[model samples]
Structure formats: C-alpha cells, structure tokens
Target: MRILLVGDEASLPAELSDYIGDLGEEWQVQTVPDGNAAISAVATSSIDAVIVAPVLPDLTAATLLGQMRTLRPETIRIALIDANASHRPPSARIIGMAHRFLPLPLAPEVLLEALTSLEELRELLDSPRLRSSIGRIEKLPSPPHLYLSLMHALEEDDDSSTEDIAKLVAADPAIAAKVLQLSNSAFFNNGRAISDLRGAVTRLGLATLRDLVLASEVFSAQSLSTTERNALQARALTASRLAAKMLPESSAQLGATAALLADIGLLLPGVRNEHDPAEEGDDRPGHAEAGAYLLGLWGLPMPIIEAVAFHLQPQRSNIRSFWVTGAVHVATALASGLPVDEQYLARVGVAAKLDGWRNSANDLITLPADA
Candidate 1:
C-alpha cells in the first residue's frame, strides 16, 4: 500500500517511519510537509491512505482531509491529534473526516491495528471491477445531526442517565430505530436482544453507541420511495430478528447485523456493476456485494461484511459449520418468501436444524406487518 504522511517532519510520529518499513517491501510511505503537497501527491499518484498530524505547514488537518475527500475520495484517512492540548477535542466535522483517530505520539500497537484493518479490507475487496464500481458511489449520506446531539449530551452531562440518551434518540424515531438495530446486533450486544432504546443506549455506553449511531447514517433510505423503503425495512427488521434466532449465541449479533444491512447497497447509486454483464441482470441480487463493499469501506468487522457480501450465495463461502453467513442466507431467504437452498444446506451439516430455523422465521411474517 502507498501511504502519504502530512505534517512537519518533527511533528509526525518519531518511530512511524521505522514501523512502516517493518511492514514489508510492498508498503511505501512518503511524508509531505503541507496540505498542498499532500494534495499534489494524491492527485499525481495512487495513495491508499493518508495520515495527518495536528499542525500542517500550509493547512489544518480537517481542511487537507476534506480536500482529500474529493481528491482520492476512497482513500483511508487517519489523524493523530494531541487530545491533551488546551484546544483539544476536535469538531465533529473533523472527527467525521478521519475514519479513525489516534492520540499524538502514537503507540505502535494502535498504528499496527489501523494498518492491519486497511490491509484486510484491501484483501477482502480484491476485485478490481468491484473496486472501480465502489469508487463511483457519489451519494454518501451526511453524518446524522441527531448523532451529534447524542454525542454532546453523553459527554457534557455527567448526570445524563441512559434514559436521557435514549430520550434524545427517541425524539427522532428514525434514528432511534437504528440505535435499537445496532444495539440488538452482535456489534454491541452479547448474544441476546436489547429491545428498548434505553437498554440499547445503556448497553452500548458512550463510546460504543457513538460509533453505532454514526454507523447508522448509512441505513438512511431517503433515496428510496416510501413504498420501497417501508417494504424493505419490514423485511430487514424481520430478517434480522430471525437471523438472531437461527445462529448460536456466539454468532447471533453479527448475523442480525449482516441480515439487516444486506440490502443497504440498494440505497446507493452506482452500487451495481454497470459494465459487468454477469452482475447487471438483477440489481436486487447484486446488492449483496455492493452492501458488503460499502460496509467494508465503513470499517465494520469482516464477518459482517463477508456475511452480507455472500448472503445470496452462501456456497461461495467455505461452510465448515453454521455461522453468520449461513444464518443470514437462511433468514433473508425466509423473509423474502423464497426457498432456502436445500441442496446446499444438505451438505452444510445444518439440514436437520432447517426445520427449527424455518419454524422460528414463520412468526416473523407477522412481526412488523399487520401489527
């Protein structure tokens, strides 16, 4: 991977260069003294990621990263800021620009984890065609304003109880539902459900819920018609619940999230492979890869991404045992009123459990509809 480092030569991390060199021969790192230099480098070459320091010679970190938003829109951006400074706590806008933030004088472990995530995403999205298609995603919904309010309330008021936070999210039902969805998913919860918004907020605490609420922005279905949006939401909600039932305790949360977000790609334009005839036949089916790509880009866990990416084609995955991908495939098929892949299931070692799984999904047909 090609990386661009932006800041003063001294302001940047001291051992960062040594760490990058240790990553191996395929990695290349360059330091740019200012925002203009960083922009020029990105424009002239292919840089997979950029790291920013608090002080840039020509521009602030946010300004440079904001410009990079268009220059290499898909490139990963990380900022290392001194949280202890008097003028600390960057604005939400700045926080939003960098995919992840690290304290300045960065720890080697934190940097390694960030780099590993980048490399893993690259490996998961190895398809050049898919990468090109994802690049055309022009309409990423802005981070929700409600989330900003939630963050402020949680941080500023030490007395703010879980109920207070839940009240804030509940004020916007649209955002509240998303909170519950993520809370119920394996990302936040253990294996069981957290049905209420307050419970979700309480379970997620301050930091975890902030990430979930921000992640919820992609769930916005404004691009869809009322009819399409409602139908899809109903299906997703039911599928997520049923998926939770199908998976074992250890895997339920991831399964629910995968099933819920499996169709999220349908909300974005240019998500389908326009030039690839094989993927052009049906947009709905193609949504699996698109949604997975989008989630992968958002830095979700690999299991969730893989589950959504191959929901319709579970056989594409090595089915050693029943897990997130299998649960999502079964639940989504049942929710959509389609037949499960019996032939595939017969070989998956879960054919006997199919009866119980389908029985669990049967009640989902009545869940959000005719209530």
Candidate 2:
C-alpha cells in the first residue's frame, strides 16, 4: 500500500516508517508539504490512498479530495482534522468527499486500522471470477433525480430545511415511500408513528435519508424478476432493521446499511454465480463477495464494503470483535430464519448476546417468514 500524506506532520514519517518497514515490501509512504505537491504525486504515481490534513497551505482539503476523486475514484481518500480546528469544513461536506475523517495528531494505530481495512477488503474480494462478474454489470445505481435534488439543495443551500428536503423526496413517490417506511421501522419507533413524508425525513435526518434514497434505487433496479427482487429487498430491509438493533448506537447505521445491501449480488444481473452455494466450503466467491466488489468499484467507504463482504461469513473476518459485520451476519440470519452461527458467535465472545437478540427479533414483525 502506497500512502500519500498531504500535510506538515514532521514525526509522522519516522513513526509510519517503523510500522511500514515491519510490513515488508510493497509498502511506501511519501509526504508533501502542500496540496499541489500531493496532487502531483497522486497524478503521476500509482498511489493507493491519500491522507490530507484539515489545514493546507495551498489548497483546502476538500478541494484536494475533489481533485483526487476525479483523478482516481478508486483511491481511498481520507482527511485528518483536529477536533479543535475551528476553520475545518463541515463534517458532512468532508465525509461526502473523503472515505474517512481521522483526527489530527493522529495515532499510528488509528491510521493503521484504516490501512488494514483496505488490506482485509482486498483479501476478501480478490478474485478473477469476481472481477468478471462485476465487469458484466453494464451499470450500477445512478442516483435518482430526487436524490440529486436533495444533494444540490444540501450543498448549494446552507439553510436547507427538513421540509424542503422532504418535498424533494416526495417528488419521487418511490423514494418518499421507502423513506417513510424506513422511518417507521420497528427499530426506530419513537412512540408515535411517522405518517407524513416530512415527519419521516425529520426522523431519519438528512445523511441517512440520502443513503436510503440510493439504497431504494438499488433495490428497485431492474433485475430478473420484480417478484424475486422485491422479496430480496424486503428481506434485506428487515435484516437492516434487525441489524441496527444488535449494535450500539455508534455502529448501528453501518450495521443497518451493510445488512441492507448484503444480498445486492443476488439481485444484480451477472454478479450471482449459480454454483456459489455448492462451492461455499471452498474459497469460491459468492454473492457477498460480488456485492462487496461492486461497492468498492463504486468508491464507497471501506468499512461499508468490508461489512457487506463479510456479513454472511463472520468467521472469515479473523477479527473477533462485534463489529458491523457480526451484527449484520447474525441479524441477516435471524431475519431469513436461517440458523445463526453459534460457534462463530462464541468464537467472537458474543454468543451470550444471541438469545437476547433473538428475543428482540421475536417481538418485531419485520422478520420475513422462514425462507
């Protein structure tokens, strides 16, 4: 992995060098004093990732990230900002530009975690067959008109209101319905129901509603059959809600989004391999792998792609923590009425929590009938 640091971190080079040396060959780090040099390196070299500081001498981090996105959409872009940096751009704007928003005076481990995520994602998805499957896809989810309108209103208008966003969503009947349905999800119940589109938009907030619009478009994308597609989508949505209930509030959104898109491969035209299930015991890739590959190709954040890739096979994750992947795996299983991997859960030290999760699922009406 070659990382480009676009900041004035003096000690970062030595610290990162010590760590990178231990990782052996194929690891490189280069630092540039300002955004112009960083852009030059990025344009000329096969840079895998770029980390920019909040304050830049020549260019704003946002402008640099935007430039990187245009140059190499596949590059994992990150912003390192100080929490106390008053001039830092709005987090929403930065998050939209960069895959991650790391804090300043960065810890080596935190940066390492970001790099390791990329490695793990490659380990899970590196396959010639998977590449061919994704290549066959003529197109992926193109943001619908309403979604574009929402983005414009948020970006161009500082005072964009919930009602204004709701109006944009409501213009497209499909997205509005999904947003309303998601807001009324069993996991998000706020005592009273959300019957109006504006109310639903308010409940979910702008960022979440924006993501859901994309998800709704993907689920409703043309596939083999509407009946089959709707079934997969409904099941996915149910698992999404269940997955959210399994994790703490901090990770719930990631868990939900990952679960919601886990079966995307099955719906995509050329991504699903019929022989995947039979070859599951081997290293053969499956729908989970294919969907993850698609997400990565689209330049999504690594954590989301990682969770989608490993949601069904938590043991393959190697890490034993109850991360987004574990939540998605168990929730998806319970939603589909498939047996949760008790052994895998036990291995992760989360087995004792399964019964409680099961009980909670039992109380919800979202879980689809035993598939």
Candidate 3:
C-alpha cells in the first residue's frame, strides 16, 4: 500500500516513515512538505491513503484535503491533528473533507491500525467491476430543500426554534410524511401515533430529524417499484431500531442513522436491484461503499459514514470495541436474509452477545415477515 504523509513537521515524516516501514516492505511511505506538493503527488501518484497534519505550509489542512477529495475521491483521508486541537471542534469544511481524525502526539500502533483498517476495507471492495460501476455515478440527490432551509436558518442564528424548524419541514409534504412515519414507527415506540409535523419534529429532535431528512431524500430520489422501496425502508428501520438497542446511548443515535442509510449504495446509478431476481447476474458496485462515498461527499458525520461503508464487513474495521459498524452489521444481517458472520463476531469478541440481540431484533415489528 502506498501511503502519503503531508505536512511540514520536521521530525514527523522520519518517525512515521520508520514506523510504517516496520509494517513490512509492501508498505511504501512518501512524505510531502506542503499542500502544493501533496496535491501534485496525489495527482501524479496512485496513493492509497493520506495522513495530513492540521497545518501545512501553503494551505490549511482542510484546503489540502478538499483538493485531494476532488483529485482522488477513493483515497482514504485521515487528519492528524494535535491532541490539544480537540479543545476546539473542527470546522465544518475540515470535517467534510477528512474521513477520520487522529489526535497526534502520535502513537505508532494507532496510526498503523488505521492504515491497516483502510487496507482491509479496500481489499474487501477491490472488484474492478464494482469500481467501474461506482465511477459512473456522477451525482447524488442533494438533501431536501426544507432540510437545507432549516440548516441555513440554524447556521444564520444559533438559537433557531423547534417551531421554526417544524414549520420549514411542514412546508414539504413528502418530508412531513416521512417524519411522521418515522416518529410513529416502532423505532420511536411513542405508544401513540404522531400525526402532526410539529409533534414529530419535537419527538425526533433536530439532530435526528436532520439525519432522517438526508436519508429520506436519498431514498426518494430514485424511482423504484413500490415493493422494492417498501422492502428497503422496512429493512432500514428494523436495522436502525436494532442498532439503537445494541450500541451505547451516546453512539446509538448515529448507529441508527447509519443503519438507516446502509443500503443507499443500491440507489446509485448503474447498480442492480437485489430485490429483482432477474438482475441477480448483473454486475453492480457494493452498496456499502457507494453509500459511504455519497454520504462523505455530503459531509455527514464520519462515524455514520464509516458505519455505512463497513457494515457489510465489520471485521475489517480497526476499532476493536463495539461500534456503529458492528451494530449495523448484525442488524442488517438479521433484517435481510443473510446469516450473521459468526467468525467476524468471534473475532470481535461479541459472539456471546449475538443471540440476545437476535432475539430482541426478532421481536421488533419493523422486521419483515420473512426476515
């Protein structure tokens, strides 16, 4: 694997190069001292991944990463920032550009693990046919207009009210319907149906409602057979609910959101519909990566993006502990007809917890009868 290190740090390049060299001769590490050189390298080289410092000589890390995104959309991007940098949150532009953030006073093992994880994920999705198919997807539908309006309002003023957000959502009938449906779904378990947009908005809160808007917009963008759309939506809701039950409270919301959008790759242009047996023999890109690529472009949270990307093969993830990817993986398997990956579960040391999760998932009403 060819990894690029972009920064002007005098000592970092040597230290990182030495550590990466220990991984084996198959790993090639290149160091560039500034953003211009980094961009030139990416444009000229087949770099697999990049680790960039927060500050670069010619440009900020965000600008460098943004250029990288345009030049090499497939290359994995990691932000290597100072540990103290976490005191202030990253700008939205930076967050949108990088796939992962590492607090650096650097740990060799952690960096190695991140690289290894990216390598593993790449291996899982190495099919040339899949790459060709995904490459053909020129554009994805943007988030709903109402969602954009709500975001703009919130950004223009820190204290946008729920009423204002709800009013915006209500202006779009399709979005309002989706918000109401989700609010009343088993995932919420509110005991009574939510018929009003304002009530649904309050029930879901701004963060979750925002995620739902993105998901709903993506799903609605394409024209699908009613059966296929319904099936996909039901499975997503089931997986999301199960994910909420499996992950920690802090991460559960993001996990659910990830699960909700896990199969979005299926909607990308040129992908065959798995629901149609006639399309079984057709070559299509893996839905996980396609979905992640779209979400990454849209600047969703990295956890949600990674979870969607790796849900199909959680064992490839570098994170050893339970995470959104694991929950979504198991939930997706249970929601679909696929068998849960026993070996992956064992490797992650979560095999013991599966049966209980399976039982709970089975009882969820969102699951289809066949599932």
Best by TM-score: 1
For model 1, residues 38-148, the per-residue Cα lDDT tens digits are 999999998888999888768988888888877776687777778574133456667556655567677777777777776877776676566555554444443345655
lDDT of 2 at 265: 70
What's model 2's lDDT at 269? 59
Residue-level error in angstroms, candidate 1, position 169: 3.6
lDDT at residue 257 of model 3 (Cα atoms)? 81
Query: Residue 109 of model 2: what lDDT?
Result: 84
Tens digits of per-residue lDDT, candidate 2, 67-169, equal: 8877766666778777565233345555456655566677878777778776666666776565544443434443234554566578798899888888878
**Whole-model Cα lDDT per candidate?**
0.71, 0.71, 0.74
Write the residue-wise lDDT of candidate 3 on 191-244 in tens digits: 987778878888988766876675566567556676777688778877887888
| C-alpha RMSD for every candidate | 6.7, 8.8, 8.7
Q: What TM-score, over all chains together, does every model reach?
A: 0.73, 0.59, 0.58
Q: Which stretches of candidate 3 lie over 4 Å from their true place?
A: 1-135, 144-160, 181-195, 203-212, 272-284, 367-371
- Worst 10-residue lDDT window for candidate 1 reads 362-371
